[model samples]
Target: MPELPEVETVCNAIRKSIKTNKIKEFVIINPKLRWNIDANIKKLLSKVDIRKIYRRGKYIIFNFNHGSLIIHLGMTGIVKFLKNRHKVNKHDHYEIKFQDNTILRYNDVRKFGSIHWAENIEDNFLIKNLGVEPLSDNFNYEYIKKISKKRNVVIKNIIMDQRIVVGIGNIYASEALYMSKIKPNKNCKLLSTDNFKSLVKSIKKVLQKSIKAGGTSIKDFQSIDGSPGYFKQKLLIYGLEKCACGKNIKNIRISGRSSFYCSNCQK
Candidate 1:
């Protein structure tokens, strides 16, 4: 699945290239995605000007005069811009054609990706209860420390919770915990203020680094340009057997997601 960084990359790319551009065509080759797309979406978006494009969590929102178009790139989904002459791939399920013939196409091996039209994004159920963005002012160490007292779950689970903080996917969560020298399985009650401070900084650092590298391309993730992200080469603990501290890494599942840490390095 595309995480925060990947989604942000797509938003930035789309915003830069297509903002204020006029859409001449909107096609849904597969309305049977994660949810059925509105039958009138094509008519609603045709000839509409894209006011802006942005990301909220993993969903991409395209702002227009009438409303917003929300998109989610579920597991194995990718969106790319293609020329009119390029043959549409077998997985291309949705597309938008600009007046200039530029195509913004969505492809997914699994039909789990979705596109929804909404008058306002806040009313969208998918993002209604989402937590603060880790890079935003609301996700400071003080906020985390306060929340920590009320939650008894594993520290990793708290950080990864979409209700507590949005966009801290498993890969970045593990990397941030490892960077903060906190074991993934540590209880929230066991964390100190200093630990929370380190966590906030590490989370921002890792996420920013990943976005700068265009996001980690573990499986199907790729930039809007179809370029693979370079951050995976810099992964420290996730999916690794050895740590930089010359210690064997430990693997455990937290909330059914793999959590990697070096017992000798993380405390």
Candidate 2:
């Protein structure tokens, strides 16, 4: 599944093509998704002008006056902009034809992605409960401390929780914990203010680096140009057999997600 950085990359890639463009048509190849698409969505979006494109968590928002279109690239999904007459992949389940003849397509092999129409994006069911953006001012050490109170889960799980901090997925949690020299399985209750402060910094740094590197592409993640993310090459601990400290990196499952850390380095 595409995480925050990947989603942001998509937003950046699609922005120019989508913003201020008039949708000539909404082509629906398959309406079956994780959340079924409304049959009339195509008709509803016809001729709608796109004013902006952005991301909230893993969901992409295509904004216009009085309405917004939300999309989630659940897993194995990618959106691409192609020339008007380009070859279409079989997984191309949704499409938008701009009045200028630019083609935007959403393809998902697993069909787990979704599309939604919302009159108010902030109040949409999917957007309402999402936690603060990891890159925002709201995700400081104080906020982490406030949310960690009485929470017994592992530190990795805590940060990965969308309700606590949005978009720090499994990959980032492992990298951040490793960077901060903290164990991924460390209990949230066992962490001190200093520990939380380190974690907050580490998370922000790791995420920013990944975003700059165009997001980590272990599998099924690519930019709108079909280019795989280059961040995986810079990954420190994830998927590695040994750490820089020359110790074997531990691979443990916390909350059913694999976590990588060097026991010799991370506490």
Candidate 3:
């Protein structure tokens, strides 16, 4: 699945080329995605000028004259711009043709991505309950300590919760915990103030580095320009189960998700 950094990278690329353009036509090739892809999008979006494009967590928000378009790049989804001679491929589910003949194509092999039209996008249920962005001032160490005081769940799971903090996915969560030297299975309530501060810093550092590198491309992730991310090379111990650490870096299952951490360094 595309994480926050990957989604932000795509949003930035698309904003430059598609902003201020008018939507000439909109097409949905996959029916399963049509449910999330608003049926009245064509009617509401026709001729509406795209004013800006931004990202909130993992969703891309395209600001328009009367409304906004929210897009989620689920698993194996990529959005790319096609100039002339734009041809739709097998997984190209959604396309928005601009008056300038530029094409914004949304391709998702898993058919789990979404494109929705919202009159009041910020108030929409899809975005209303999201927690603070990891890079924002709202996610500081003091904020995390307050939230952690009442939670007894594992620190890894707490950070992974979208309600607690947005965009800390499994990979980044594991990476951040390892960097903070906190055991993934440690209870959130037991975390010291120092640990909380370090975790917050690690989350921001790791996410900032990943965004700069255009996100980590573990499986099927690409920027809006169809470029693969380069951050995977900097991973410390997310997938290296056999790395020779003084203590084992065991792979454990937490909340039905795979977690990787060095037993010696973390805890």
* Candidate number with greatest TM-score: 2
Clashes of each: 0, 0, 0
Question: What lDDT tens digits, residue by residue, belong to model 2 across residues 65-181?
Answer: 868999999878899987778876787888988888888999999998999999898889989999999999999999998878778888898999998789888888899999888
Model 1 lDDT, residue 139, Cα:
94
**Arrange candidates by lDDT, highest first: which order?**
1, 2, 3
| Candidates' C-alpha lDDT | 0.88, 0.87, 0.84
Scanning candidate 2 in windows of ten residues, the lowest lDDT window is 12-21
> For model 1, how does the per-residue alpha-carbon lDDT over 123-158 read when each residue is reduced to its tens digit?
888878989989999999999989989888999989
User: Would you list the rank order by TM-score, best first?
Assistant: 2, 1, 3
Candidate 3 TM-score, C-alpha based: 0.94
| Per-model root-mean-square deviation over C-alphas | 1.5, 1.4, 1.7
lDDT of 1: 0.88
